[model samples]
Target: MEAFAVPGLPEFETGDDIATAIEAACDLRGDDVLCVASTIVSKVEGRTATLADYPAGPRAREIAARFEEQTGEERDPRFAQAVLEESTDLVMDEPFLLTETRFGHVGVNAGIDRSNTGGAELLLLPKRPSESARRIRERLSVDASVVVTDTSGRPFRHGQTGVAIGWAGMPASRDWRGETDRDGHELEVTVESVVDELAATANLVSGEGDDGTPAVVVRDWTFGDHEGSENLYRSVEGDFVRQALREWHYEQ
Candidate 1:
């Protein structure tokens, strides 16, 4: 599969037609999957907040104080407040607050992005990324899939990598549960996150900083019809990491 950036997109704003802009910049084809950066999706959806919008509250100040003590860097109380407001739960307090977002995504700062946005503004993840992708796909004439992506740091990993936050027109995972492996061993748990793989591959062209290419078209990929990114999340009851972290936090 080949992924190429969709060029010539102007700085997007609230209410801008993303599908039209993408079609104008690239030669869209049937069966192509479009990997769109979540930042642009947030921008177009008007999901932005200024520092003034998130004044430091009691919880924000408490978290900020702990964060600063651990990092040795002054934490912006307003930023901390915004992170808390965007999160459903604060899973950690030191290093950085690992938060579970309203949409059930766990990450630092609830994926509230400060980079690439104009100064003094922060971009939140789209309220419903799968819905956003589906809308974009419906607006375009070509039969294609859409995957909304964001850069995220993995546990124990040094660098950030692209991950799929929302998707439409394709299964987020490919399950090989009943299939046999090369050694004829039945694959009980061998699901592949095809959406995330596509997002990471698309990021090869859509760089992290100043790339200006927020969207990419991936060609020559096969996918089954599926909707949403819910499959990408591990259920809370089954998440061993979360359970262990909760226990560790109580011990501390």
Candidate 2:
């Protein structure tokens, strides 16, 4: 399969149409998977915000003060308030703000972007990424799958890679469980995250900082005969790492 970015996409505005913009820029096939940067999706969805928009309450002020005292970096109470407002649960709050967004996404500072905000102070993620992907897919002329992607740091990973926060017209993963391996042994537990892998491939050509190519088309790639599954995020009840973190006390 080959992947290339769609060129000539302009700086998106609040009311811009992403589906039409991408459709005009390139010809997409039904089999092609379109990976879109969440930044552009949030831009067009008008998820931009300013720090002043969130008034720092007592809780926000406390969190900010504790953050500054522990990290030795000044923390803004309004910024803390913004993260708090965007999150439904705080996974971690000491060294950094690791929280679960409203739509089940877990990320630092609620995955708020400070860059490429179209002059706004912040760029919040789309309220519902899968819904955003579905909307974009329905607007397209062809039946292409859409993956709404974002770059994020992962546990035990040194740098950030593209991850699928929302997807449409396709399953999230290819389940390899119960399949035979190279040695003819039954594979008990193996699931390939197709959307995240496609998102990473898209990012290889999507460009960063000023590349202006936030959308990429991946052609000729197929899911083959593997069974598909839509299980990406882990539930707290089954997530041992999260459980340990919740029970373990921090030194600081």
Candidate 3:
């Protein structure tokens, strides 16, 4: 698959839109997948946070205090929590809280970004990436797939990598369950997260610094005309966390 890097997208104007920026960047002649950094979308839509306007230092300190108080852990968990807040989507739940973005991404943070953006404001995940993608598809007159990505901390990895929080016009996952592997044994259940893979691929070009690139286009992706970004999320019946935590607690 060929990836084209689009650099230095201008700030959005009132009437300015994602499709216009895309048209200016590349010739997306029908049937291509476009991957966008969530930061860019946030910047364009003016979704930013101002720590200076508030007592950020004191707030951070308070956060640190509250976290320690709750968990009764000595270390400052709230420092991590505050950083997480900068990147998380706050979700209200019973007893404990659950944080996840609209794209079915779950974590302590919602993928909010404080890095880059000229230090003016923190960048948030796209408001509604799938909707944004749909709009872009309609305007471009092409068979397009839109993916809005944000950097996320991995479970066992050192740093961060991009993940899909919102998508449109693309297959979110590729299932390979009940299929034969190299050993020719039937696979029980396994699904590849195509959207996350695409995000990682796009990140090769959209580096952290102001490299001037915010988007990438994949030209050789195999996609059907009617396919869109769905079928990516698994259903949750009851207290998935409780079951997992129970297993983990026993394993410990």
Strongest candidate by TM-score: 2
Better of 1 and 3 by TM-score: 1
Candidate 2's error at 203, in angstroms? 1.3
Instruction: TM-score each candidate.
Output: 0.93, 0.97, 0.72
lDDT of 2 by residue, 1-252 (tens): 999999899999988999999999999999999999999999999999999999999989999999888879998999999999999988887778888898888899999999877889999999999999999999999999999999888788798889999999999999888899789999977899999999999989985688899999999999888899988888889888778777765577
Better of 1 and 2 by lDDT: 2
lDDT tens string, model 1, 106-224? Answer: 88889999898745289989987889999999999898899999999988779999999889888788876677778999877667899899999988889999979999999988865
TM-score of candidate 2 versus the correct structure, residues matched by position = 0.97
Count of backbone collisions in candidate 2:
0
lDDT by residue for model 3 (1-252), tens: 788887557755334587778877778866777888777777766766664433446544655565556666553433334344543344322112335656556644456566766455555566677676666667775777888877777445689787777787657876666668689998775667788888888888787776767788878877433324356544344557534543442111
lDDT for model 2, please: 0.92
Can you tell me which runs of candidate 3 are displaced by over 4 Å? 12-15, 52-62, 67-98, 182-184, 223-229, 233-252
**Candidate 2: where is the Cα deviation over 4 Å?**
none
Residue 23, model 1: Cα distance from true site in angstroms: 0.8
Best by lDDT: 2
